[model samples]
Target: MTSTSARVGGIRKEVDAQKLGPALLIASSLVLAIRTARWPATSDEGLANVEWQKEVEHSGHIAKAMLSHLISRYPSLFLLKDVPWYVPTDEDVPE
Candidate 1:
């Protein structure tokens, strides 16, 4: 019984860690955007007033990083290696 409880506790810790990963990513992205925005503009800073400078670029990078992290960490989120794209479901069958 102790072993079973210990196993379940381990699984719970792993699940909690997985949930924390995305939260950390979002918090870090916000910190990065704020830090970059607070930097003083230089004389050669081009298009200082442009909307794109307002964290949009950082958001794009963050999105890509998040996607890469998720794909690497949870490859099973995709189809099996040998599964065909044209595999039919119940909806595809004639009623």
Candidate 2:
């Protein structure tokens, strides 16, 4: 019974460790999004900055989509270089 309990405790610790990094990342992303959303845009330049930021964010989404495609469709492209280990090879892209 103690051995079974110890095994369960070890698994719980491993799962918690795995969850911690992604949880921290999500928290940081939320903080950054909130900070950006709260940015003041009083002047004309500030408004332009906001527009530019919007465009930049759109481009970022496109870039991420393209990257996902490249990674999923052509996994061999990263054979020579170190690819992100977290990105699963079998990740499906929408048709």
Candidate 3:
């Protein structure tokens, strides 16, 4: 009986760990959308800025992380060879 309960508890923990990351990711995204929905959607510049910020936030994080990893492995390619690293849909460097 104790072994059966332990096995169930272990499975429960594994399932919880696997689910928690995605659950947190989705929850945070929903919370962000709810909070930012208050912004005025009228002006052209304001809307554009919001879109741009979203792009920068999402793309920039992914791009920078990838670039940093590549740089770590192949420093010569970036530093000495002058290879231009490009990120997807990245027009300009994020500030």
Candidate 4:
């Protein structure tokens, strides 16, 4: 009986641990969604769009231009080298 109780307790702990990950992921996504929805569009966002258009017009890819912009704006987060360019849509501009 004692071993059965211990086994049940261990299973409960494992289930709780597995639940923790998805719960945290859902919570984080909710927070991010709320924050992004609440964020006001800035002039920089528009500027970035114009810059992107110009770059794409001048060349084929806006990767270099975006890299420069990211370097200037968010240097810490910027990965200038070997960065994966995954634009969501052709009309989707950087902010």
The candidate maximizing lDDT is 1
| lDDT (Cα, tens digit) per residue for candidate 2, span 28-62 | 45545664686665667544566647755665555
In candidate 1, what are the lDDT values of residues 1-95, reduced to their tens digit? 11222111121112233445565577557756676786666665565655546565666577667756875798555333332234344555587
Model 1 TM: 0.30
Pick by TM-score: which candidate is best? 2
TM-score of each: 0.30, 0.34, 0.32, 0.26
Ranking of candidates on lDDT, top first: 1, 3, 2, 4
Stretches of candidate 3 above 4 Å error?
Answer: 1-43, 46-51, 80-95
lDDT of every model, 2 decimals: 0.54, 0.45, 0.46, 0.42
Question: Which 10-residue span in candidate 3 carries the lowest summed lDDT?
Answer: 5-14
Model 3 lDDT on a 0 to 1 scale: 0.46
Question: What is the per-residue lDDT of model 4 for residues 2-94, given as tens digits with 9 covering 90 to 100?
Answer: 122211112111122233344445544554455457556666744456643553344422333544465567655522233233424423435
User: How many residue pairs clash (N, CA or C atoms closer than 3 angstroms) in each of the candidate models, in the order given?
Assistant: 0, 0, 0, 0
Flag clash pairs in model 3. none
Q: What is the lDDT of candidate 1?
A: 0.54
Worst 10 residues of 4 by lDDT: 5-14
- Per-residue lDDT tens digits for candidate 3, residues 46-72, read 445766478446754555555556556
